[model samples]
Target: MRNPLADKVVNIKPSGIRKFFDVVSEMQDAISLGVGEPDFDTPWHIRDEGIYSLEKGRTFYTSNAGLKDLKIEICNYLNRSQGIDYHYNNEVIVTVGGSEAIDIALRAMIDGGEEVLIPQPSYVSYEPCTILANAVPVIIELKAENEFRLMPEELLEAITEKTKILILPFPNNPTGAIMEREDLEKIAKIVIEKDLFVISDEIYAELTYKEKHISIASLPGMKERTILINGFSKAYAMTGWRLGYACGPKEIMEQMIKIHQFAIMCAPTTSQYAAVEALKNGDADVAQMREAYNQRRRYLLHSFKEMGVECFEPFGAFYVFPSIKEFGMTSEEFANRFLQEEKVAVVPGTAFGDCGEGFLRISYAYSLENLKVAIGRLKNFVDKLRKEQGR
Candidate 1:
């Protein structure tokens, strides 16, 4: 009998991040700094709201674009935090997490074989989603010297007539790099000149340390052309709830909503309720979580530096991508050995993209105590490797 899977589905590799995570799951006493998720619980008030909603039997499907009040809250949150304005009625559509928003945006924008430019060492979803949408993913590798930021020249070089969209995964995952206002201006110029639409994923917008996040949509003349993707996942410790939203021009968002309506009908009703509370009353919780993450970030960076690991400093998100080149092993080899021998689990950089080779992404989302323990074990492992090599 022949296999029944479609060619597109069959051709895609499973997520590289999940592959090792499955092995680590079976291990005993492994300290996993591999997963990129906040350690905090969802704030009490938000949880309370969800419980109340369930008690009130608000389990019915919301509008296909999500509840109006929730959209209004989202608009307020974005305007207050990121200085980006959107029409609640026409510009925003709540989806089942940022993943769905990404999928819908890509599907709505790209035709078969159109090129979507993606910066490398980004979140795992963009390229895969592009492929599933029948679009070609054109990867532009961000260099460590430039703090893993996408430069305008690089963006320009990657563009061709076939290029239809740029997926800007800044406030980036795994690398934790953020695009500030000046950097965004250069990109805005390119976007305007090329007339390319930007799908800006800013899920980590609330977690920046030294500098505030500047949304690409906030750049002059960019809002009309940029689709802003954000969620309650990273910022509010609500990953498991699966809530997210996309804001863009009405025409594009309408097309996205059409796809969403046919496929998903609506995001989870409970999640939307929880998300409304999250937006209205979660700022204090976000600030508290950000403080904790910042402290952990300092600890991990300091520990890595002391251990002689070369890494770029991450300004946003809760991950540190450090070069493992000195270990004289592929990232997979290093991560595997570290897990098996040291009982510490981390993701290899190659899991993100090809440019991520010779690096490993360590998430700082764990507690300070756990981070200290993991760092201590990592130090010992590095020393052991060096001694074995007689170096």
Candidate 2:
């Protein structure tokens, strides 16, 4: 038989997070902090809307761009939340999820051999999607001292004649760092001068704990050059709904819509109707969930401090990147032993990127009760490691 696998697909690594997730799934006693999913159920009203849509027999496919009303709601939500204006008819396309938006945006924009700037310890999809799009993935290694935020100097240094798209994974995954407006202004100036485009994944925008989240597209001279991708997954706890949308200049969005039309046809019809409800009426529910996550986040940080673990304070998203460098073990080694000895599952930082080697990404999306139990196990594990090293 012939070797049928494409080299590009074959060479791509499977997600490291999923590997641990699968193992933890089978270990009935294990508790997992590896996956980035929210623990909250989709708010009842949103689910009720989906049920209503089905009861009305609204299961047919929407337009390739999406239901006209959902597109308008997406624009309205963006304008209401971030003050960015986009035309619903041309600038937006609903996608299967934010992951699909990321994929199609890269495919639509890159013809081949272009360089895509990706910051490390990011969501796992960017690098692989760039490769699949036939583009070069240039990684900008984010530093822990800067709280994992991408600095302007780093972005400037990564640009080249061939650099085309920059994937800004803020309110970042695995690291939970967010870029403030001042930080984004510097980057926006650089991007404008360099004449490069951006794919800003703001999926965790509403989950930000600091001041309100800002979209890079709202910055001067940026809206035309950036594709903003977000979805209901994090904010409304609608992960399983698998609905997301992308907004950009109509030129790029048209190409993306073309790809989405042929490939996905449309996002789930029931989910789209539910997301409309989520956008229009789910604010209080989101605020409540955000507060709960914030509480859990604080508890974990306090627990880490008492255990003498070094972790930077993350103001956005539900994960914490804690340094495990003092343990005299690789992140994988520490995580493996922790899982086996403590029966607690947390992701090795290197799962996101090589720069994540000395850290571990622990998600706080789980409940406070579960987190308390997990931290108790973590404290014992840390103390045991310190004693073994005679520290």
Using TM-score as the measure, the top candidate is 2
Question: Tens digit of lDDT per residue, candidate 1, span 64-129?
Answer: 999999999999988998788899999999999999999999999889989999999999999989
Error of 1 at 104 (Å): 0.5
Best-fitting candidate, scored by lDDT: 2
TM-score of 1: 0.99
Candidate 2 Cα errors over 4 Å, as ranges: none
Which residue pairs in candidate 1 collide? Answer: none
- Which 10 residues in a row give candidate 2 its minimum summed lDDT? 20-29
